[model samples]
Target chain A: MKRFAFFPGCLIPARYPAMEFAIRQVLPRLGIEIVDLEGSSCCPDPIYFKSKDKLSWLAVAARNLSLAEDLGLDVVTNCSGCTATLSEAIHLLEDDILKKKVNDRLGRIGREYKGTTRVRHIATVVRDEVGYERVRESVVRPLEGLKVAIHYGCHLLKPSKIMQVDNPDNPQVMERLVEALGATAIRHRNWYLCCGKACQTEDIPMNMMHDLLTTVKAAETDILGMICPTCFSQFDYGQMKISKKFDEVFDIPPVYYFQLLAFAQGIPYEKLGFDSQRFKPECLLRF
Target chain B: MPEDADRDEPVRVNFRFRRELAQKIEGNLASFCYQCGACVGDCPATTYSSGFNPREIMLKVLYGLEDELLGSESVLWQCTNCYNCHERCPQEVKPVEVIISLKNMLAARGIYPEVVSKIIGTFETTGRTVRITSAIDRQRAKFGLPPLPPVPMDEVRILLEPDTGTDEEE
Candidate 1:
């Protein structure tokens, strides 16, 4: 089994532990082992924290990467925000001057970032580390006839020069993975539109979500599949708020991709923690 | 006309703010933005909000309008930081990075939204953006997952410590 250090960012553990649970349940079955990176903090958040202080953000992110570097393992993150922060930090720290500056701060704690570790979103880990054919073979319960719409939340594919996960404009990584589970992946009209979780303005996120959900609803998909817990929270919990505000009934459940994969791998529905979600993917239970 | 008279005066670009921002982001990427409106086309914030526009923000950055960009009612908060502009910009201006640098400047001036301050406080103290509680462990147990581990605050604190004059040397 290929072993990788797991960096479950703040959101999945705090607000959405089930996603973490799903990841733990699924990855091992696909011949991938997850090693927990204990004592790691938040990716220091990609938006607010980075906007507040770039140098400090880089320091915090570098500290997280340093933990993985000590283990001699590349980090796999469940949240796109964490991946973006850590990946972008590595990209910036490539400069010897910046690395030395961040190292100066890290040196205070007896830790140093040697830039030896690589950070990847779990989606890519599954795609690149474990081939899709292996995923197809591991599935005991196929999601036949289910239509899944993908939300490749911004951080996963953007700043394409740094992320290099897939084609940012027309990404098919999630779609192919969805198909591997025997489900059809539909790319909605506003598939490229961000989930807007980082937008602090109230009306801006609300309207942007309304626009994206409108397209998803029009596509008539069973559930929205996304890789980021932030986007998952926005669509699952925020969907209820958007529904009431827009006077439109958007009942489409948002399922994290790992949860879907776990379900496909024959992990019992009760074990996945769908009950705790505001918008439960009850449709998956029918299979 | 008053508008024409106003235009006649020299537009004084704040070189100090521009130079400071250049130090934060490599190459001062905002200098390369030619205002082709590519970043504006796919911007969700610009699409939904009338006041938030990346192209206009880049124009301000080029002119070094620090007061307007970092004012009390700054529109930078409206940005989603999706990096779509990074993908769309032909010149690789990375408007999102420039906007983030501008936000950092706002924060350095002790000017930012209350929510940002609260998050920063939580992260500094707990080493995580979200506070952990006994209930969080309870939630983790429900899925047969291990209890969440404590963050190394000693190290996080060191990393978060306010710089003591070393940053300006570069």
Candidate 2:
């Protein structure tokens, strides 16, 4: 099994443990091993923290990357925000000047970032490391009739120079992975629009979400498939808020892609924690 | 009437703010923009909010309108940091990064939303954006996951120190 250090950021562990459970359940079965990175903090958040202080953000991110470097393994993150933070840290620390400045801070803490570790989002780990063919072979129950709409989320694919995960404009990583589980992946009209989770303004996120969800609902998909926990929270929990505010009923369930994969791999639906979901993807169990 | 009466006074560019922003990471990427409007087309905030526009923000940045970009009721908070503009910009201006730098400048001036301040406080204390209640562990227990390990805040504190000079040798 290919071993990796797991970096489960704040949201999944605190707000949505189900996504973590799903990742733990599914990755090993596909011949990938995830070891816990003890004492790792938040990716220090990609938005607010970074906006408040870029130097401190880079230092914290570099510290997290150093944990994986010490473990002698590349890091695999379940959350796109964490991936974006760590990945961008790696990209920035490539500059010797910035690396020196950040190291000055890290050196005080008796830790040094040597830029040895590479970070990958779990989606790419499954696509590139685990291979689609292996995922197809591992599936016990095929979601033949289920239609899934994929939400790539912003951080996973954007700032292409930094993320380098997939083609930012026309990404197919999630779609192909969804198809591997025998489900049809539908790309809605507003698929490229962000979930707007980082927008502090109330109306901006509300309206952005309304537009994205309206398209998803129009597509008539059974569930929305996504790889980011932030997007999952926005679409799942934020969906209800948007519906009430817009006076439109949007009943579509938003699911993390790993949960769907775990279900397809025959992990019992009960253990996947769908009960806590605001809009439970009960339709997934039908397969 | 003077021959130059019709001409408006030249706008003064705030070079100090521009220089301070350039010191941050990729903070000066906005200088490359030629008003292509590509970033504006794909920006979610531009689509949803009337006050938030990346092209206009870039134009202001080019002119170094620090008061406009960093003023109270600033529109920078409306940015989603989606990096869609970072992707679509033909000149690779990285408008999102510039906006973040502008936000940092606002933060330096002790100006930011209360929610942002609360999150920063939470992260500074807990090493995580979300507070870890007993219920977080209880929730993890339901999934058979181990309890989260404590963050080494002593080390975190050292990193967070504002003026830890490089000369302090090991």
Top candidate when judged by TM-score against the true structure: 1
lDDT of 1 at B53: 93
The regions of model 1 sitting more than 4 angstroms off are: B1-7, B167-170
* Candidate 1 C-alpha lDDT tens digits along A127-171: 998989999999999999999988998999999889989999788
Write down the RMSD of all candidates, one decimal each: 1.9, 3.1
Worst 10 residues of 2 chain B by lDDT: B161-170
Residue pairs whose backbone atoms clash in candidate 2: none
- Which CAPRI tier for candidate 1? medium
lDDT of 2 by residue, A1-287 (tens): 99999999998888888888888889889899999998799888989899988888999999999989999999999888999999999999999999999998888878899988899999899999889999999999999989999899899998888998999878889999999999999999999888988888899899889999999999999999988888988998899999999999998988889989999999888889988888989997687
Q: Candidate 2, after superposition: displacement of residue B99 in Å?
A: 0.3
lDDT leader: 2
